[model samples]
Target: MEPDVLGLVAGALTTIAFVPQVLRILRTRSAHDISWLLFGILAVGSAMWLWYGVRVNSLPLVVTNVITLTLQLSIFGLKWRYGRGKRP
Candidate 1:
């Protein structure tokens, strides 16, 4: 298999992995168990990955990191909105 193909597959899988969590949060309307630190780190990391992808000119990294960052930011926002007054 080609490297781009492999990267696309891997990126798709990892990006898709966040879907369930987002859906679950939406369904449950609860994010008390989510961690602010973790998602904060993830958001930063994803942003860095996105930047790296842009620098390297890798479509897979760019696309996937964009998506991953979006999802992570969504989760982070949800965590903040839903976790208000809740424990970590």
Candidate 2:
């Protein structure tokens, strides 16, 4: 496949991969097993990717990282709210 098409497909798959987890968390209303550190690092890394994408003018990277960052931040917020209690 062409590079742009490949990038978009890859981006779409990776971007949507977080959906199930987000939906699960929302349905369960619990993020007890979620790792804050992991999500924090991911959010930061996604932000960096977004910045790099802008600098490099890669549309795939920009769009992918934007959506990824949004999802990661949402998970982060959910974790913060639902993970407040002790882990069991």
Report the error of model 2 at residue 64, Å.
Answer: 0.3
Q: Give the Cα error of residue 58 in candidate 1, in Å.
A: 0.7
lDDT of 2 by residue, 1-88 (tens): 9887899899999899899989999999899898888888988999999999999989999999999999999998898888766676
User: Which numbered prediction scores highest in lDDT against the true structure?
Assistant: 1
Tell how far residue 53 is off in model 1, in angstroms: 0.5
| Model 2: how far residue 54 lies from native, Å | 0.3
Predicted candidate 1: what Cα RMSD to the true structure? Answer: 1.6
Model 2, residue 66: distance off in Å is: 0.4
Worst 10 residues of 1 by lDDT: 79-88
| lDDT per model vs. reference | 0.91, 0.90
lDDT at position 67, candidate 1: 95
lDDT (Cα, 0-100) at 59 in candidate 1? 93
Q: For residues 5-57, could you state the per-residue lDDT of candidate 1 as single tens digits?
A: 99999999989989999999999989998888888898899999999999999
Pairs that collide, model 2: none
